[model samples]
Target chain A: QQQVKQSPQSLIVQKGGISIINCAYENTAFDYFPWYQQFPGKGPALLIAIRPDVSEKKEGRFTISFNKSAKQFSLHIMDSQPGDSATYFCAASMSAGHNFNKFYFGSGTKLNVKP
Target chain B: DAGVTQSPTHLIKTRGQQVTLRCSPKSGHDTVSWYQQALGQGPQFIFQYYEEEERQRGNFPDRFSGHQFPNYSSELNVNALLLGDSALYLCASTPDEGFGGYTFGSGTRLTVV
Candidate 1:
């Protein structure tokens, strides 16, 4: 089964604090994992992504840590800001056959960063 | 480059009705994927279109169908809508696997009465 599970259905943090969301998957065929940010009245956008070959990746304030053995990964926001308050989703895919087509997504976690 | 675009930001329909939602992919993108996000839940994959063909599909029933045009634009048609079908529909576009992460459209919010 293609399934991605995310934790911390909701998160609240103070500005400058670290905000983290975790996800686990059952399918080992998945090679690409991406994190998306979504605000109200908008669609989710790709914030950052990671491949299984790497242990971690960082882009500006966003980072993704991956564990190939455990089939687990997570997103970390350094120095969280109020503007970061939104819903985040973790998704995985078997990029090989898809031409990167078929992808699976996690339920999502709503983050509320306070000033 | 212009990002993916969708139509009819919001719509309302009653049970047994049919609805159509449209999407235009980002500039230079050739593939489009559709997703359904219910309240407080993650977006579920409905289907994906590439090269003007239905390349893949999710677990959704046949009532949930779609079409893709040569221009890389796409449409999602839901026949005999039900209350459970009410959700935010999103469209995503990408060039190929090498291009990576998708660019998603703002989405069409549908409510069923």
Candidate 2:
């Protein structure tokens, strides 16, 4: 079973425009939600992360809006740039106990920003 | 500080052969985890090691096994490789206690024929 589900397998946006990707999860045990950006031939880099306690967290142009009640979260990238054209992945993990930090990742959303 | 480092960035093996991959965690990190990523797919967790012990594992088959050394380096071993085993194997590391994100290596591209 896919623990975390992401939508819009691919996305395209003009430079300086806003790009958004959404994700949903079913496991209530998940407490840490993180977003990663991966370039071809490289590893996924940690972009930003949020906890269930906060409804939203923003870092630079990247923002994560999380809704614990709905079991959903979304990533918003402001001022999308061509350099941002890559794959974005949302992951959920338990932050405590034995299963702590074992990430369950979404399939991923490929983003393209046309300059 | 160096990030996670994986060895033999690429490999090719025949079906029914065995393979081993190595990883060195970032400085000051004591935990290591392995993940398999198929083309165009998200990474699937294989297992995690802490304090030189296997602490948790995903739903992978027994053929996928791992070992963690006292120095916090880890190795993943696969017995009797299959074509389906062809994928990018990634190694990630984290501190023993923290909610911090993992640092990942570039990964090893494994191709099975």
Largest DockQ belongs to which candidate?
2
Residue-level lDDT of model 1, residues B6-91, one tens digit each, is 99999999999999999999998988999999999898999999888888898999999999998989999999999999999999
Q: Interface RMSD values for the candidates, listed in order?
A: 1.8, 0.6
Worst 10 residues of 1 chain A by lDDT: A94-103
Residues A72-94, model 1: lDDT tens digits: 99999999999999999999987
TM-score of each: 0.97, 0.99
> After aligning candidate 1 to the native by TM-score, how far in Å is the CA of B68 from where it should be?
0.9
DockQ of each two-chain model = 0.71, 0.90
- Show model 1 residue runs off by greater than 4 Å: B97-99
Question: Model 1's CAPRI class?
Answer: medium
Can you give the lDDT of residue B55 in candidate 1? 89
lDDT by residue (tens digit), candidate 2, B1-113: 88999998999999999999999999999999999999999999999999999999999999999999989999999999999999999999999876778999999999999
Top candidate when judged by lDDT against the true structure? 2
Encode model 2's per-residue lDDT on A1-115: one tens digit a residue.
8999998899999999999999999999999999999999998999999999999999999999999999999999999999999999999999888899899999999999999
The prediction achieving the highest TM-score against the true structure is: 2
Instruction: Note the Cα lDDT for every prediction shown.
Output: 0.92, 0.96
